[model samples]
Target: MAKDFAAMEDSNRSSNPSIHDVSDPARRTVLRGGLGLAVTGLLAPLGAGTLAGCATAGGTAPPLLGFKGVPVSTADAVTVPEGYVTQVIAAWGEPVGVAGAMPAFRFDAGNTAAEQALQLGMHHDGLHYYPLDGSRRGLLVMNHEYTDDGLLHPDGMKTWGAEKVRKAQAAHGVSVIEIEWKDGRWQQVRPSRHARRITAATPCAFSGPAAGHALLRTAADPAGRIVLGTLNNCASGKTPWGTYLTCEENFAFYFKGPERPDAHQRRWGLRPGDPVGYRWHEFDERFDASKHPNEPNRFGWVVEIDPLDPTMTPVKRTALGRAAHEGATVATTKDGRAVVYMGEDARFEYIYKFVTRDRIRPGGFAANHELLDHGTLYVARFDADGSGRWLPLVHGQGPLTAAAGFADQGEVLVKTRQASDLLGATKMDRPEWIDVDRDGWVYCTLTNNSSRGGAGQPAVDAANPRANNTMGHIIRWKEDGDFDGTTFRWNHFVLAGDPANDRADAKGNVNGDAFACPDGLWVDARGVLWIQTDMSTSAMGKGDLARLGNNQMLAADPKSGEVRRFLVGPVGCEITGATATPDGRTMFINIQHPGETPSERSDPDQPRRISNWPDFRADGRPRSATVVIRKADGGVIGT
Candidate 1:
């Protein structure tokens, strides 16, 4: 079904796994009044006669309306742009019985210590395709987020143990599969009633602006409004009405804290590497976060999900605060409200945006599910000449209320980076993903930082215009053109690595060659620019040329800023979390983890699998699938 690629078959190769199902809906309307048009991206990088003058004079090219170039080869499967074909769809414990049975992952039973509403949930990251109202069949809201315990548990998880750690915390959260594409392949529709799985015992609800506050009150919710679980979830963003959201990256590894210090560890901010419970807390001493410091404040923020009502409860919004969150994008604000945009992924941490105060009335999904719930979060400060400013953490701004030391707005939102480093913001290089193109720009991704001191410790600004950024960059902004305007204008368009590790200039690769920690991001709707990498530069044998190569996926050319590479995965993988299939010829990437294989390290039957790979269904157990790239005439891919 991937046909417009021009050529490259045997079902166009494949690889992509980690993101699960929904099985039958095809209602795609996006053509009505052209739905406002939007999504243009165009920028720099073109040559080779400008992609051979768009192709023809025997070079052939003219397929847009869908599918373009960026094939990226490696085998194991999924590599379109020649007439796509990747359909292995759903994975991760193929069962949805409601409380158990995904049991074959074996990462040493460390499912974050279980109770995750019935297990089979581990590492699936950001996904959303909902649809349903007109039928064409849909629903694929995934984001399992963590858990590897060695593989799921057979020789791993037992920091002390408890029912193998409550089936590894019920398997780590979120999953609503019910997909479809009929005979052209793409299955997984078994358990019905929308097939739920919300986890940590699902029952969420906490509107915004940090709900109840008091560091979020513990002993499990205590009036902070029912907060039991929603750890990690990672990279997600959907609401324009359909509802999906999901954010909470790395939730500081479920917390463990016990370096000894009580009075609830001096009232909350407990550090000592932050553990207060780690052994799954013997299965439920509230998971023991040092007798539960509000259970890590109920995990970073941004939840949302309602994929056609999987019993609808998942709603952690909290006016969007809580750090290490990695994703959230939304968009609106011209006057219609509903903003969103976020990042806070650590390193220097910051970059946010909320707005909301309820405005969006586009109608549907119960009015964007109460339009996100009271907003205006701001934070971001940049400048050295590129200009930037979102500021306004509210509560009379300057020093965030409660007399300055921030004892309000939930400690100015759990120390939202010490109130954006005292509202000065700007300290990036690990921002991680935020995407938003169709021309409102807003990209984000900074992903790299060797502790920056070879020169540049917060030096050379202008929205982080590289100074010690070894292999990482992709900033962008616009706002006034809308997209929730908050005073914008920024740059640093594409500076990845390995064009021979850079130094070439005029921009053509050089500084450490090409590819390093760019980290999960996406923009495709024809603006191109994919990126994706993470493992502190891939981390395999640690040679660090972004982890010895093959953790790729780059595109660029947003109208000629031509960056290439397209695909390379396999061997201790990392090229993760991507989304497409509104007819971008189906691309759903997410290879993830893959590490620890040197002949499987001390051998357990040659499991050294750095990637026996998707090798695209020819039989080679390296499976981790989610591929479907098309173009032989269907158009609109990398065009």
Candidate 2:
């Protein structure tokens, strides 16, 4: 969720009434009934055994492994199905091609900023495997979402030096490494020319109409055409032309107070006097909004990187608009135009989409490089009846005009959250990662809203039916006709919670493998949707959520709404970022921030570690790592 620093403020002092708490009693009753029916319809196929023998698009049965799920675990090691095997490919602090041959990782000492820039970052989030020759060997591009100051520095953020600040910055970007499936095992191809790292210090270029806009201009780049780095890169996506799209999320917390902060900055949760902990402004004047003012504006856009070309500088496509962007997933229009869908991970924020004007040209990556530069950005609005419309964010059209403080189209893209507010877009719970299936149905994870059901938060609605949605849910929608159309029909795919608490379906039935806080999501080529969890630290292993055990990965058949627990992570870790091989044999998942308990995050003095997963070091330091899973029988995974 947008629960970085700004979300912390909301949970602490916000008093606005929930938008979902309607005054109309009849409407509320109708919505409640509709939600129950939606859940029933979504899972109806599962009860009838329709999904038991479903086939992929290629007319072959999906490899669901048929291995019953391992029980929910709180162990200090990863738990997988009986017949599956997992191996750690890479972990934080490991060398990833700095020079020709990278040095070994040293966990005992603090790494310099230069060394960090060359190593795999701290928290591994979203990732993708791009096959080089259609299979086996490929480039793995992953996002280093954020940093853990408590672990990065022994003394923590309260006593950080200049080098410590820089090291943290270097550890907050993306990493690309070359790997291959050799002898039935996945291993990194060390020192390969294809391996590279993009850190917060790496230089980047800007594209699209908002590239050189006034709001983006900085002292370093007066022309506003270039930027220094990309920060808080969360989930990611791959383009049809072979490139990685890394999203800059929760960026507002990185910079200090703005010179002349406005409602826009406040709406994004960047307020003065807030102890962001990183305190980057103390070392780098550019991070201080008061000095550079516009530096924060340069980040928080969908950045595209070509992993195949190691020399290529990442480009921040500004036409996609800016916010706490979780990520962007793309699908082609019937006419071949590219459409990208994204979600702003904030409470009451809106989901967005961008449609390129020109059709995707067939050929090399250079030929279609500028496709995202020219497009119409839109925000979604779902009606109570399950129908929705995409409202275009064009100046002088509707409420996005001079009267609304927007000068032109550029302003609309830069201050997208403001434009969304002016257009009266529906305030959702917290929309996170989104994925589009082969059938063009889009699935989004609304990762919980603790502020809901309270007197000053958004109330229950048809789409977000729960008052205090502690466990979060998934919603799916199909466009009215095609990817380019504005109208669509949507419904709830799953309402995640603890099944033992009488959290039954519409027919009073519950599954044994219940989960909460759906975050990372991916759909394999075999049509099996992979769902990951990120439970709140305070709620983990407590109450209804405790019964669900640690965060885990679940496989769901979208056609039947049947979900099965596939794997569970160690204590105090979130199971996220998943991708499977073309044949669905090798699957990669990210285990982030293990051993970071609620007490460790809040009470630094009396810190307690929960786990030291991946490497169960006796020193009590945990490292985030990526694990590769393949069936022992060499069959397609998740069968």
Candidate 3:
């Protein structure tokens, strides 16, 4: 999730042992050995073959990276290697091409709420491309993390009304668009039947153990079986049975509560005033916690959508144990059971994993409807000696009994953070996104936690060894046996910062390129680990972070620990979400919140002061869009 809307409060008040507090902290400082195998012969890479329904293929030791690394860039444009080209396919406010109403994006920001519904939502984040005709045509499903009202209306927040609130709400959710390769470039198919927008008002079903719990029940949804919409959708994942996993992060920021919230609300970061000043509660009663107390509980779960089937209602899989989920990455066990690894994007949080009780059947998505529901969710605890344990969050187990505030499985899953707190899960430095490599190793991005080692905050630990960690690092772990195993060994992949910095804490151990705040992550064919960074908008091109330039994407060799800059985004934007064709020739990535000012919002009268990307029209407001990249010589990307 972007820091602009993240929950600012440190809610975990637990005394669970930090990795440094465990035995032998000094021995745990060094990263573990190189990821075992060479990247060349890995069986199933993350993109194309693993995602686009194509037969997985590999060579007998192909080079991990073949392109020349681009230098650090501060320019207000997309920068790629010399042999590659990029095109803007989908952007915020553009028509999603739904039938009967395809509203074009208004450069002056005069689009109404009704028109915004028919168009693409704002701030494209995590996305996946599902092939329809062998990558030539596919459904590009992406998440719209949040909306910037300053750019949504012509006059911005100068005036407030219900209609303006509705427009802002309309711009928060997910977009599924049909895209195809035409005339050597990717394009959105107009009036596409597959085009659909799931917004904050869209109806969604709740499934899994915590579905109908009293905490999730509200006046509008008394049965607790339905939720109005899924907002704050950040990073994403795809299921083995062909479904999209859109995660809800920073949902706590939307609600406006009383002067004093209850324990449950406080635990979830709900406070007295509107910390984010979203002001949605003034227009929509549902956003008022004083009115609809349980409405906030309805969100913060991973939603499963079948992008290929628009008729199907998206389901909020409750069994995944919610906690401001950054994203869910799925891997299968030796016997076909699904193992899901998720990260909660907040300070002092814990990593979670879910293992289904039943094996995935022969049939497609329908046959696995209940697979995610009947799983055992576990939180990770990284020990000082490089070992870790997955503590099960089951009712009546360990400290999660009736005496500890959990009465049943539903309560255990609903209060997941409290449950993990009682089980002594290791406190981490803002776990963001989790992905599994072909070698069965799980990697997660720990975006910097400025509060670490500060006064009245958790001190620097072995797993998170920096005080006021400005530049973040990546943590990787390999399970003892399969993805569903109860134990694993973990280590840091790289500490991200400039090696020449005067401050020792800010100088990272990066091998090739110096980058900060690693966020989005993916492993492509030939086992190249792609990393995307999201430096805070206020800090980019300033202070020690200035030398790093704008937010960029880099390719890393897992075997040799070499990182190379692949692409640098426009000013004030985040380079996130990566996908590629089945042939590995074409690739897709999202540029989010371009022209974002230091305040994280643009001034309506002077919006173009920061950036004017993709379409630099005089009246244009910076728009978040998806960029398509392919090699000029018609060869595999990065090769």
Candidate 4:
């Protein structure tokens, strides 16, 4: 479930499913029944005072640095507009999981759950910062989607050895860290109640319609009473009532299923499709597609966790349905309903939104927890003319008719792919991240998919128009009347890649496009779209166009369609996991797998420093840390 952009573009595996990768089981474009998410993979200070109204004349505001939409020079470090500084917060191996400080990290030594519990997990992805009661301190919850087998074990991990495999398992899961700003530097509060880790060994429960469905039943969970753990957590969100929502991505590879059952050979579920990729079955019998046809049903759903209270077991809210759930971003509706926008993350998959029934009572814990349980889940059906509609997935609703084979709510959730198919939701080119700006516009990143369905593959439509979409794009739309409704207006904002490349502007979408593999996404307080890239070509050391080498984080002025690359990661790295302080004076961005390449990567202190990052840190370890960017005056960021 974990791979860099190179695997996304080059490897046939569905890790990222560039265009053609979707149609086959081995490929990512297809959804893994119950597996985990293909855990996925940025910075910059924003400028001055709520520069009320549009960007001042020169893309800059009075008394503040004008944006000018000018591109930053390609350098080997982080960049900020002006008067801003960034600091590293944590790295992959720094202590956190245990009761006290972590021992010197041994890439080769054996670390048990107790030892690993104190250290940070691998491939840090989406995160949440929960302000603590009466204190400037907050809880930082992060997802360690998967492990870097080579980096975790002394010798590369061999699946055959339970000891090595356990270490690898110990590395997979979530890490909750306690962080507070002291003397202006964010430091960990060692021995704090807020710091903790949740791994594959952690027990979790399933909720919603499919909680006890037949597909989820396993030998370990004969009655489907429990799910052992949550794997490959990618993008995530925070509940209005203060819980954290972490998603499971690329979950299929974890299980070693048997052969493809007769049903699979006929036609795969909901995935637009995949033709080739990893033969995970070769590794373990659990991966056998035939024996556990229903195994995949257990995963690929949005999970909810309460970080403040670490012991408050996490849950998979299947009410949101399952697919390659990129992540869910929750917002309130005009009527006070909690609306969560989610992306399926597979080419041809659908974009969905779940509007809760109970109104979020703002700071109302009891109300918010119940808000997600009951909601109307809708899929997007966009038209070529830019107008769109939401197709309902309610049991027995418009498209959830008996003819579709989804006669009950559980079926709708377990077979979300089929439910969406019946609704005819607009097919996309690998939609990955979804966010809602304060302005109410919904933005999504359709990460690159080299295969445009093909002769039989879905063609480029208005919503997704590009045959071989090597240069991915970000698209946005406003709900009808600028409200989150059933219908909306849409437009392609930016096409990605080298500005000089002719194909970059294939559909006039490249106006502000300067990077590829637009994966992780978020909207700042200023309405500026923050985009981070996952470039496989760069990770592989191939040609520059595909291998820009340095994946960057860009800020886009949506109204003007202007964009800029404000930060670039180290060698062999992809920028990801970004969040801004409420004050906007400081912003936190994650640098994951700095040097993780398709062939190999370097260790923490030795050979092939695959990536030399978080360089600005006072400590020279160059670990993957959360970089906090702040303006000197502590003024609002990105005016």
Tens-digit lDDT track for model 2 on 1-639? 313343564632233333344333134221221122332233222211223235668776544435687788888788999889999978988888645647566665366777788889888988998888655888888998887777776556556578987888888889998889887688888887888889888899999988899999987899999898888888988888888999998887777876456766666666675336567778877888767778888888999998888899899999899878897998998889999999878777779999999998877578888999998999987766666789999888998888879998888988888888777676777888999875777899988876665676666776777766777888788888989899987777777775446543211112336788888888777566788988867778666777788888888766556678899988888887888767777889899888767642523322236676777767647888999998898867866
Q: Candidate 3 on 1-639: residue-level lDDT in tens?
A: 666344367653556656666555555444323222212222123222222322326533345678999998888899999999999979999999888899888898899999998889999998998999987999999999988877888888888899988898889889999999998888889988899999998999999999999988999888999998899998999888989999999888899976879887888888888747588898898998988889988888999998988888999999999888998999999999998899998888889999999999977778988889998999998876667899999998889999988888888888898888788788888898889876777899998888888777778766787898889889888899888889987777888888778796788878888899999999886567899999988888689898889999999877667889999999989988998888888899999999888876676434545788978877787899999999998778877
Each model's C-alpha lDDT?
0.56, 0.77, 0.84, 0.64
- lDDT, residue 548, model 1: 35
User: Which is the leading candidate under lDDT?
Assistant: 3
Reference-based lDDT, residue 15, model 3: 62
Q: Write the per-residue lDDT of candidate 4 for residues 1-639, one digit (tens) a residue.
A: 135322232212222222222222221121121111111110112233333543556665443323423243334466555566677777777777445566655543455645665688777888767777323577788887666555565444333355555555567678888888899788877877777788766788888777788777887688775787777788888777888888887775555444343332222331222212322344433445455566667778888888877667888888888877777888877776788999877656778888786677866454466567787788887665456788888888786867867768888887776667656677777788888766666788888766664644565555665677766777777787524588876665566656555553332334443567788898876666788887662333554354354677877665455666677766566678878666555677887776665554443223234445655332233345577777677666654
Error of 4 at 555 (Å): 1.3
TM-scores, all models, native as reference: 0.33, 0.92, 0.95, 0.83
Task: State the lDDT of candidate 1 residue by residue for 105-164, as single tens digits.
Answer: 322222333323433365566766665632235667777766544445545433335665
Query: How should the candidates be ordered by TM-score, best one leading?
Result: 3, 2, 4, 1
Task: State, as a TM-score between 0 and 1, how close model 2 is to the true structure.
Answer: 0.92
| Model 3, residue pairs in steric clash | none
Residue 256 displacement in candidate 3 (angstroms): 0.2
lDDT of 2 at 152: 73
